[model samples]
Target: MVSTSTTGVLVLLGAPLGNPEDASPRLRTELARADVIAAEDTRRLRRLLSELEVVPGAVITSYFEANEAGKTTALLERLHDGKRVAIITDGGMPSVSDPGFRLVKAAVDAGIPITCAPGASAVTTALALSGMPCDRFCFEGFAPRKDGERRRLFTELAEEKRTMVFFESPRRVTDTLRAMAAVFGDDRPAALCRELTKTHEEVRRGGLAALAEGAEADPPRGEITLVVSGWTGPAASEATPEAMAAAVAALEATGTDRKIAMKTVALRFGVSRRDVYEAVLKAD
Candidate 1:
């Protein structure tokens, strides 16, 4: 366990993803109070400090996912030495879909004082901007990059009653939007937020199909966040093999090749691709 008298406290500060205005004053105070600053991207941290109009000269080090496992120990050593260690991610909250989780856990286990400098969050931003149910929600970060893995992941959240928020690469936003449309239905309301808080920022609210169609026609080029309305539960008798086969064939018709399309459909059905494929062949 860390000696609190020596270790002091470790603060997890959230940095603004884009807009400098999103940086809370609390974050500024925390950043200034730290003896050492561990940033996900030291260069980005430099940029943020520049924007915040404060020049930080503390001992700064990188702590991203690539080296977080190793860096955790190094940072912990600083904390154990009675230094104030403040950790910051590039955006939102540290460890919220970022790489600060390990360091936070280590500090907690060692009895080091830990606190958060709450600031911007794409999940909450998109949810409120989406006009979806905000009382309860889940943040799924980024969906799996591979199409097959994405299926099983989304399947687990198929019946989630709370609103869902996801982060996606701008390059794959169209494809991901279409996937959401297929599973959640073309008419399920969703919102696509691009370049949030920037000059060209846009938030388009509509059903999944419309967002997918628009994004496909003119792809967006910026950070993308999505807020999807939750399933009210698979409406009566919808989780059937016939429904499964239909989703697959329909996706296939929409220029989706058999393999990737089949996997996505299987997720909607909560079944096996082999089962879905057999049903597909039988239907034919």
Candidate 2:
């Protein structure tokens, strides 16, 4: 039972990554005025509310990864009822590797209006602090967890020319760095940004090998963001056929399927599979 003329607005709020002080005044006003607030972590939202000294008149509900799909439908219902709905995550903007993408997509398809209260983001924060080339960069989100998967991912990105940013668990950071070193090269410049925008914030900068060794010697704890300088070596298009064959052999040595390795080499060299196959034939 909803009125067609009373379609509600969906507000996407950007929560502060760590410091409560980073919360914007507009965010506070929106939180207080919202009719329903869907939060990634209700407890964290409460803490934020307490910190902001705002007593929300809205009904707050949990909307995290596990429950996002099931809860989007109910939230959409509220929107149809013309309720001002707000979605906030534990940190940064919702839907950027966060839980709000489903809801946002649903709202869009349902013809509901959507707005955002932009705030601090760890991605840009880490990138800005890294001192790398930020004119052009790509956020790769969190790197794959499995060893082979992680290595393959780094291998694929080996020829990426733009600066890259990634989020990683402190527990796997050292291993991840080692893998990056193996593929991206030991001397590849990178920055390990830990506990960004908070007390005890630290940014370690150097070659991948040094960073990996430092991380191994003293394990870092807290939220971790890694900023890496992209491929500065010779372009893949300029690579010789022998070089392509050697690259494929290197991957094959690491237990990658022969076909998959060939495909990866072809991709890295910006050549077709047939070209790579011919290179392999010449090498043999």
lDDT at position 194, candidate 1: 80
CA displacement after TM-score superposition, residue 194 of candidate 1 (Å)? 1.9
Which candidate has the highest TM-score of all? 2
State the lDDT of candidate 1 residue by residue for 1-284, as single tens digits: 86337656789887776899988998888777788999988998988888887756569999998899999998999988988899988788888889889988999899888988888877787777888899998889999888756655665666677889999988889888877776666777889988777789889989988998999888888888999988774443665667777887767654567886677666555667898788888778
Give me the overall lDDT of model 2: 0.89
Q: After superposition, how far is residue 240 of candidate 2 from its true place, in Å?
A: 14
Per-candidate Cα lDDT values, in order, are: 0.81, 0.89
Q: Which runs in model 2 stand beyond 4 Å of their true positions? A: 1-4, 235-284
lDDT of 2 at 193: 95
Error of 2 at 91 (Å): 0.8
